[model samples]
Target: FNKYQVTAKPFFATDSCISCGLCEKACPVHNIRVVDKPVWGEFCTSCLACYHVCPQQAVQYGKATRNKHQYFNPHQ
Candidate 1:
């Protein structure tokens, strides 16, 4: 977790989101809805399952994903 996390919310690049529904499926807390726009529910625990599973790399967690090494753990 971030001690100084800037806004705990999933930043979906809607244009990049291919509407694959992986984000919704990967949501551990069932807090995401991929409609015209991704509707993030209040139950989000920030588990980041969807962020990693996203093949399109559309789901981002703040600015941390920018040029950072992605720890791809599909077995998780």
Candidate 2:
């Protein structure tokens, strides 16, 4: 029997987002989108530049992360 695994978690933009579009611009995969609200595309590699570059500290990943400081890093 084979077990299926899901490794990637979708990036969520928090209400603290200032909509500055820095995340979108910094995304190497171009998966981050900024409209009136920020959206994560399927191409997201979980690079975490959005979370790091966000001036408002509004981006996070995973349900386990319920704090303002927890962030996701693809390289790590």
Which candidate gets the maximum TM-score versus the true structure?
A: 1
Candidate 1 regions with alpha-carbon error over 4 angstroms: 1-10, 74-76
Candidate 1 local lDDT, 1-76, one digit each (tens): 4544423464655477888898788777787888865667666666777777787777787676755554587676
**Global lDDT of model 2:** 0.69
lDDT of 2 by residue, 7-61 (tens): 2345677788789998888888887779976787766666577777777777776
Cα distance off (Å), candidate 2, residue 29:
0.9
List the lowest-lDDT window of 10 residues for candidate 1.
1-10
**Model 1, total clashes:** 0
Query: Per-model C-alpha lDDT, please?
Result: 0.70, 0.69
